[model samples]
Target: MRSNIPWLRTIEQFEDEAIASTAVRLAPMGRIDTDTLLSLHLGMTDQSVSTIASRADAIAELAALGSFDHAKLSKGAWRMFKDRIEFLGCVLPVGWLVPERRRLAPGQMASAGENARVKNTWLLSGLICDVETGETLLDRCPACLNLLAWRNLPNIWSCQVCKLDLRSVTPRQSPPEAVAAVRELARYLLKRDIRLPAPLGDLPSPDVLKFSAWLSYFRWLPEDLGLAISPKNVPAGFLLLKRWPTCFDEIVLKRMKASTAEDLAKGDVISRIKAAGTLSSSVARLPSAAAQAIVKSRLETLFGFLDGSSEGFQDVMVPISELVNSRF
Candidate 1:
């Protein structure tokens, strides 16, 4: 359905602080009705009344289905409203209609490197998952199983480690498994919140909250995939390395293989571990206090390849784009 909601970046920037202030601006003296609320808060008008009502009706239906509370319709609706609008906006420009567009919106008026970061954020948000395992895409050096930093590669697809030109390297013989998931995600994003398909198995179609949480973790891609997969209250240090098929060199692998939690605890490394409440703030989202600490200590020791590198997140997203294109 056609939507008039604003873009993802626009809604994301409309802070809660601004909302209250904007509400006050709309009603200087007293409480306002829904019509006034729409006009003042969202810059709506008579011409757009139908559009707003349709969206509200959809949210109301979802609330009826036990998806969320809509009785406190104004505030709850705004949050839900922003998410659906932003997602649908992304769908047109970045997801389904990408082929028809000539170029992505430029990063002009943004500070240095901001454009690339924005683009990568959108790209990462489009990740196609293994519906069963939640395993997303990753690009690796087939020879060494090393994660290829595609941003640093030459025009030719050369492996940084074994120096093999992978352009002619045949893809795996396995069937393309992620195609259905990718389409399902795109359809859910383009349309609105609905029950996910049978293949997804009762996972709620992607919503603002779910997408936002994933986006938070997604900003830190391949390097942080370790965190994305870690479960609540679990130690992530050694477990993260053991859980995922990550790429590590012989020296680093040997160091990781030989190290114990005690060794990690004694290691001298600048830790970024901080309290994040239930937001999965532990390093690599390690839930165990000791695990978080252990992973914090060894972060520099183990994943030193990404240490102090600005290119870690942006450069690592190339594989996702490639994976998406392969399906088409």
Candidate 2:
């Protein structure tokens, strides 16, 4: 047994090395689409078919679990071939996520660098609209009521100084009016029992957009949840909500005996990958009734927590912590 020890050590070390290399490759790419990440794990680059990405996730789960205990029985005979798993399993993906998209991300600019304001401004879109008329509202600036930035003061359409409805003096833009309409909708939702985010788009950071767009459909909740969500992260919130109860399920973090883990191994890792595939960002292109329901549920739960009057959120900004990890 002692003589065979080196063999097991080498195999375990190789697996760790493989996964680490892949993590390094993935870490720098910023936000990577989960589908691409899984495809790389499965050892294909051409994207020859549209197989669900979770198959690869299953394989990766198998790989992650397999790493914990290297095969003592197979080590001596398959030492060399074992390296293939690490290379193919992990290294391949590292290469795949590294700047290989139709549109490359621009490098970050420091202060006084490239025009940061323009890039950020263009990065966002105004999606405000009136619920009753379904008309796109204008940018009703809260400061001067001249259609500028989004604000959270009472009486959304009122001019900050004069306390007069700006629309009475001058026509409000579609975006601002749309936001106001959404807030009113939020108020109505709280009056009832439904939960949702409101004001269309009032959040500061772009990350908030994902939740706003997701919860926008269920505006019967509270406006405090989604208004002013930043534009950049709207997509991620969508992605997370799409993968609920399993992607971040508390059970995913539970501890089990080694034997139980092994018992689950038959379907454990593979099932995870498949589950992940169901929500992989790539799923956005495909339509499924079941998928839509799951996504909708997640959006409901997330905004439900945010919209609850007890949360005491006064402004339109969503806290990064609650947006990401609120178990409720």
Candidate 3:
């Protein structure tokens, strides 16, 4: 064992150098997508297909474990790769990795800083509608309903006028009638995607849209559970509800069944509304109570126009009373 020490040390030293060089190349890239890896070029040399495949497999294997511990995860991956793979050296130069895509995120890439505003506006849409003004209100002292300016109210957590903590201020909630109207508008927009404005063509991906919608709508439940939600987040709360068949309670379900001939028609609004609410800022920004009242009035008129009978109109209106008690 003593005689073999020198030989073992030499092998270890070489391996350490190889690992360090390999790490340097990959560190900046963070994680490479499959297609990008296939055609990867470093300086004047192109990476071998076999080398990329092995690296991809190793990364996939580590990801499969779903662990948050970086040290433990890396160690495990290293052990598995020790026998089969060797990190000879990086095939690419550092210069090749420096690109605009790495520096500017998807949201940052959006023209005129619209990405952050879009998300913020979506999160604040319900509150905007709740206000009688029908305009986007970013910073208002919730306790006194005094408009707060960025120059005066530098500290967001505290209210300038009321001197009360902003988090403690309860938001003015829109009526259920307003919420249903917003949902109906969301449904209409999704069904007519061809009519969507040119500016909103770059909406978030499907999964992100679903998550944002969920967050916007369901934020109220946490507030109900004694969470200190700021009044500014009130619009986010309204945005959380999605139009699933199960989202509505028994009464609304019965009403929908009587009105629509098919179960597919009943579930249609639920499936479509998620996409609608996520993509269109205009739909989200519609005046809450005002929009609902408009929708209700239009719907009543249309129903009357289609069926002149008072009995037929009464059947739909009767179910809408149950709309006030809707859960979705």
lDDT of each: 0.31, 0.29, 0.29
Q: What lDDT is reached at residue 225 by model 2?
A: 40
After superposing all C-alphas onto the true structure, candidate 1 shows an RMSD in angstroms of 21.1
What candidate 3 gets wrong by more than 4 Å, as runs, is 1-119, 122-139, 186-328
| Candidate 2 ranges beyond 4 A from true positions | 1-127, 130-134, 140-184, 187-190, 193-268, 274-328
Top model number, TM-score? 1
lDDT of 2 by residue, 1-328 (tens): 0111111211222321223222223322324333343344444344321121123433343234234332321121101122121111221111111111111011211221322111111111322232333333333334455432212223223333445443443333335544554444333222333322332122222222233344332221232444433322233333333344443232222321123223323333334334333333322421233434444344334223223531221111222323666576
Q: What is the lDDT of candidate 1?
A: 0.31
TM-score of 1: 0.24
Clashing residue pairs in all predictions, respectively, total: 1, 27, 9
Q: What lDDT tens digits, residue by residue, belong to model 1 across residues 276-310?
A: 11122323333234433333333434443235531
Kindly give the stretch of ten consecutive residues in candidate 2 with the minimal lDDT sum: 96-105
Candidate achieving the largest lDDT: 1
